[model samples]
Target chain A: MSKQGSASALMAEQSPGPLVAFENVSKIYGKGDAEVRALNGVNLQINAGEFVAVMGPSGSGKSTAMNILGCLDKPTSGRYLFKGVDVGGLASDQLAMLRRHFLGFVFQGFNLLARTTALENLELPLIYQRIEKARRRAMALEALETVGLADRADHTPAELSGGQQQRVAIARAIVTKPSLLLADEPTGNLDSARSHEIMQLLTRLNRERGLTVVLVTHEDDIAAYAGRRLDFRDGRIVRETRNTGKPSHAQ
Target chain B: MLSNTLLMALREIQRNVLRSGLTVLGIIIGVAAVIVIVTLGAGTTRQVGSEISKMGSNMITLVPGGDMRMGGASGAAPPFLAADVEALRRELVGVSAIAPYAQRMDQVIVGNENRRVNIVGTVAEISVVRNWKVTDGRLFTLSEERSGKAVCIIGATIRKEMMAGMEPLGATVRVGKLSCEVIGVLEPKGQAMFGGDQDATVVLPIRTYQRRIVGNDRIAQILISGADSADLSDLKLQITQVMRERRNIAAGERSNFSVIDMTEVAGVMQTTIGVMTTFLSAIAGVSLLVGGIGIMNIMLVSVTERTREIGIRLAIGATEREVMLQFLVEAAMLSAGGGLLGITLGLIGAASIAPAINVPFVFQTSTVVQAFLFSAAVGVIFGFMPARRAARLNPIEALRHE
Candidate 1:
């Protein structure tokens, strides 16, 4: 019976499709002489439960890619399939629905609503889902507990430290139980020690909750924490690597 | 969705308190001004109507015309004769009373005090027809009127002015070097509907005024009072017929003397004031347009300021309709709040000023409610453009905005 359960768990893990897939996506900014290619012919696939980091210098299209993956923006061309659904042809409302149902975004600045408490920020996605108040509060508290921010749920973003605020932002991102998480320069504003702590938290969420994280960053040290890396330059992916070593703190 | 939008709007307004307050002020003043002006105008009309009503709804005035000139002003129309008054009283079925009156403005001297006062000459029945009450003493007798005796009735204003500390009853006052004994002191009537000082006058018997002051034996004008039970339109027709026949006027020709009905005059005045109020309110409505423009301007700024926030919301699954509704609700709330406050302030302002200017204060519930609704409509009309712009914002571009 134990052998059968192990085999079924392995199958369950393998059965879940790629959480996010980009098929020859290209985003062009303007026409002819004023033309700028924000994302030029990008193709990538991220499996469920994988923690992937996208690293690129300025003007390298990493931000543009992150925006498209997060369903914040539509690609100028090519298909973006989020959880096997073609997202390229989706209307603005449909895109929003996709984002609401399957995607969660975290920004580097924490991007917490300045005056709102951590609990309210966490409930924002549920508000979009039109969830009832009592249920939303319970879900928000559960998410806060997941992020170890339950005690500080009532505190506003302004009252929180940089690490605590980012945790609240993470709680907000995951409160909806989205299939994919997109973090753009999540620890760019934090010091090295704080950045390491945030990376550790992301690793824990990836391992325990089995959340698929696609983090965009410029830092090499930040990318080292991820199990897979895609590096970009001049709006195109230049390299891809699998990190076979244990994460820096894991050693 | 609406509640979420409302929450976002409230948060935005709270974040920028001063700008929101300023935006609402424009609508507030506009609505308040409209309410105050409309209320005050209505109050003034009511006050005028009531004053005219006090002078008797069935009263009519007949002015003099034609030859037999008195006091020798070369071929000028003479004063109305007693025959005209007699014909009106006898022939007209709806006629209740006739009082032939002659008026002269002259300096009246009562011992040490002297002042210019309007002196009216008419029979004692004039007081009843004109709705004038005698506060003290008695009206002149018919014998006194026939004999051209010097008995007179003085108004409260004239009595106050000429006799000051002394009681005016039985006091003798000289008008144009003729002494007349005051038989009664008329009550204070205040300003007439036509802006005349009704209280600042002296009344004497018609014969006495003609014989002693003007040195003529003719009436200046005839005051006609209709029966209380008679319809005013029917009475007017009857009076017109009697006067036309009395003067032998041909068909299609206008009557030489004008017969003015107090009720008709009052109606005309009310219609005129009503039109004026409408015109003034239309002009005041221009302020609402200005207020609408102000709202649009502020909303435009708000949209620009919150473009990033809008992007964030859009990215998080807020639809264009949600964003549009958010800003639209904010604008509507601003104008509606302003309108509510404006109506309250306007009523207070109108009520405070109406009595001081001798105008009746009227609080029209419909007008107040209409003003409030108008302000809400203004918000909607003006807020649409900015809200549309906000809703149409590209999430990616907006998020990228610094």
Candidate 2:
């Protein structure tokens, strides 16, 4: 039984293909002569618990692809499968259900509601989930603890440091205990130290709880923290790099 | 769930306290205007009803030449004579009593104190015909009415203005050009049924008025109180006929005299007030439109300002329904808050101002409730378009907004 388990583990590491798969995706904006094809015939696969970084220049359609991956937008033509369930066939509300249960998002701006306390910000996703107040508070506090922000629960975004605000945003993202975290330039607004701190937080969330993270960034060092990097040019992935990992700097 | 949303809405309003206040100012004024105007109109209507009743039920007034309209009559023909009053009393059926009165706005002097008063020359039956009570002393005797004695009954207002600290009975007051003995003082009727001081009167015998002051038999009008079971309209007709015959109007000619029924007067008053209330409320309701526009403008701005926040919510699993609810809840809180504030302001305004104007202060729960609900509906109706716009935005584009 132990030998069979070891064999299957090695097979899983060799081919981690079942979690998410995108086949021949395309996204077009406008029509006819004015049409802009954002993504054309893009193929990609991201397994569960993979920390992937997407890097591209302005107007390169990396954002479009991320939008599709997060179920925030639909492709003009594609088959997107999460856990082998087809995204193209899912309705809006079903996509919402998928997002509610499986996905969390962080923004470069820290997008913590400006006047709200960190705890309130963290409780937001749970509020949508309709969890009762006591349990929601408990879970929000726990998420804050995970992001090293339990002491700053009562502090508003405006009152916190940029790194703390992003920490609160991360806490908000994880409060629902989602399997996948989508971050768009999560440290884009911060200094080097704050950016490093934010990266470390995301790294810990990914490694410790096995949360899948897909981040978009322009900075090479920031992209280097991911286990895998997909570089884009024009609307196509031009190169891919698998890193040995950044545990030393992340810690 | 609703409470949570409401709390969130309130937090947003509190966060932008100044902006929220400015946004709802129009709503507050609009709502307060509605409540105050409706309340004052209702009080005025009530006052008119009671005033008509206080003229004594089943009452009719005989005005000369049918020319008296909303205001006092300035005669083109001739005034009603003492004989016309007598003839109505003698010839008309279902008449309980009759009194003829003439009015002169003049300065009455008691010692060195002088004030303008409505000097009325009427018979002793004036009290019965008008439901007037002489509080301090007796009304002029019938012998005084016949003999044209220089005696007068002061109304409560004249007493208060002229003789506030003194007993007025047997005190001689210089009324117009004659000195009349104060035989009585009338009970205080705060305001007349129409809209003036009912208490600002000094009554003397009609004969004394003609013999001493005006030196003519031209009385202003005659008041007739109908018996309890009498049809006042029929009695009015009877009085009109007798007055026409006595005044010698030809059979085909329109009667030179007008017999005015109190009931008809009351009905006209009611209709006029009803129309006035509706007109005023309609004007006030225009402010609500302005208020709704204000709400919509603010909400549109809010949606635009929070576009990225909305995108964040949408991207993190918030349904369009949830987005719409947040904005809608914000709007409702704004208008409902304004409504509550407006109601308090209106009640305070009505309470303090009505008494000073000598009208009733009537609190109507229905109007208050209706105004409040209407304001909230205004929020919903106007807030919906902006909220829908916010909800329908493409999340990718919204997130991309700077």
Candidate 3:
């Protein structure tokens, strides 16, 4: 077993192309008489600057896969590599560094802190980076401008509309200029028109800024926007498809 | 990092203004009570020390009982006599001056104006032993004491009452209908350490008092002075033995009279006031403990209320230490602010009452600093558990929380 592990370690040291790669990863909750495996031997690879979508039913473990990919949770047993580094063996602090340097997460709930202004919300990520006040403010403002929400920078979450609040969350996520942008049901809480607007903003960021995007959603209409789509069933990716259909130019 | 924590703490406090204010009220009361009690106690001690010092450190008083009763009362034993004074002076190695005094409260009349005052009849040596400074004229002469003449020295209060518009020196004041010529006016002594008006006194010769005032030759109290070069313990022993022999007391039996050193009395007063202040401060310190608990409770609530915020900070890359420090800083600010206010109010309270009660006001820098530091400590200690709880929360769970 030790010889095999060393041989595989040598193989891992030899190949380093994907930004994030998962090989036969599985996560199970409970054991024996009552067991629930959330992920089952999933294999996937996400390259830099690629926009991918994960589509599945409620119990298909898409969220679990997203959590593992975002470095928020560890897989039960598997080999996961983030930027050529073995993620499963990394410490909590190392995982935090990965999250800070490589990944930015935008949740569906428009998770802007209550009673905090839009500018302060955007500055939250840089605060963790220990950036100085002047630099943090400037970066937050630039992110706000990128999201076309600079005019509402001083308004609080309560004062902004659903779309505007989501924009602030996006600004907060992107302010650190992370390599990967993870959006979990990014347009789940918005109306159809607002959802399209938010999706367009994400697409623009991914195309223009060369930021890798991983979007999780159950809706087919939302899944069609991604350049590539992966379908999951019973905790395993059952299908992969490229979006070769005609593009809708409705702004 | 510390400044960031402090800013976050300030913002959190500002966000929940009423909740934070209510939580810190306990500390405010606790710190305030401690300051007021300690300040007043120190002021009282200072006032007592200065009053005793003014009466001359070398003076020793002979009370009627051997620490038995609280106040002076007529006992079965005869009063202290002039022979006991003479024996003490002769046998004691550190002999200075001795003055035998007797007192009675009676109305003194100067024409139509009459006022009640303590009439003290003492020997000629009282002037030197008691350090009684004369404002005008002079104390009773030795000749007047020897001849039992009706001559008296009046205090500031008596002079004000009897000689309101007239010159008190060489004026005549009647004590219980017997006219005695005032030979001197004593300077203002303010108040006595034991709660009596020291300025409301009229002094006359012991012989004159026995013959004309109370019609008794017995002395109520004796005042002795120790020589500047003599050891206090040796003088006390010698005086004790001499007084015992003069009173004819046998071996093994406790003496009827007690000789108390003024310095010893001052020491006892200092200890009593010190203990009282500590006890009051302890009671006040309970409020600080309650204040600490309040801080803990509010911090706990704050953690629960800001769980999502904590998760966001964690996701953004804040370490657990940073989260813990933020909450701790908030607690410290509340407690320190309360402590500062308490010290100010306490000083004000002490200063306001010191003059009314005739105690010299004093401010102790050490006590003020101690109270402030203690208040801050309360915040840190009580604030720790809540901060730890906030830091240890699961980021995933907290993010999912509504």
Best model number under DockQ: 2
lDDT of 1 by residue, B1-402 (tens): 677777777777777788877887878888888898899889878987888778766887776443222222222444568788778777878667789877879888888888788888899888778787898998889899889898889888887777888877778888887898888999898876546788888888888888888887777677888888877677768777887787778989866665677777777878888898888888878888888899899999988977877877787777788789889999887788788988999999998998777788998989998999999999999999999999999887887676
Q: B2-114, model 3: which lDDT tens digit per residue?
A: 78778877887888788877888898788878887888888888877887778776877776766633225357656877677677767777757788878889888888888
TM-score: model 2 vs. ground truth: 0.89
User: Which residue pairs collide, candidate 3?
Assistant: none
Q: What tens digits encode model 2's per-residue C-alpha lDDT throughout B1-402?
A: 678889989998998999998998888888888888889889988888888888888888877765645435456767877777777767888878898878888888988888887888888887888888988888887788899998999888888877878888989999878998998989898866546787888888999988888788888778889999999878877886787777788888877667788878888888898899889989988988999999999999999999988887787777788789889989988999988988899888888888877789999999999999998998899999998998888888888888
Q: Rank the candidates by TM-score, best first.
A: 3, 2, 1
TM-score of chain B of each: 0.89, 0.91, 0.95
Candidate 2 Cα outliers beyond 4 Å, as residue runs: A1-17, A56-60, A190-193, A218-224, A237-251, B70-79, B105-116, B158-167, B171-181, B191-197
For candidate 3, write residues A84-157 as lDDT tens digits: 77789876666666676567989989888898999999887787677899999999999999999999989999
Better of 2 and 3 by lDDT: 2
Over 4 Å off, model 3: A1-16, A244-251, B68-74
DockQ of the candidate models in sequence:
0.54, 0.57, 0.47
- DockQ, computed on Cα atoms, for candidate 2: 0.57
Model 2 Cα displacement at B335 (Å)?
A: 2.3
Q: Give the TM-score of candidate 1.
A: 0.86
CAPRI verdict on model 1?
medium
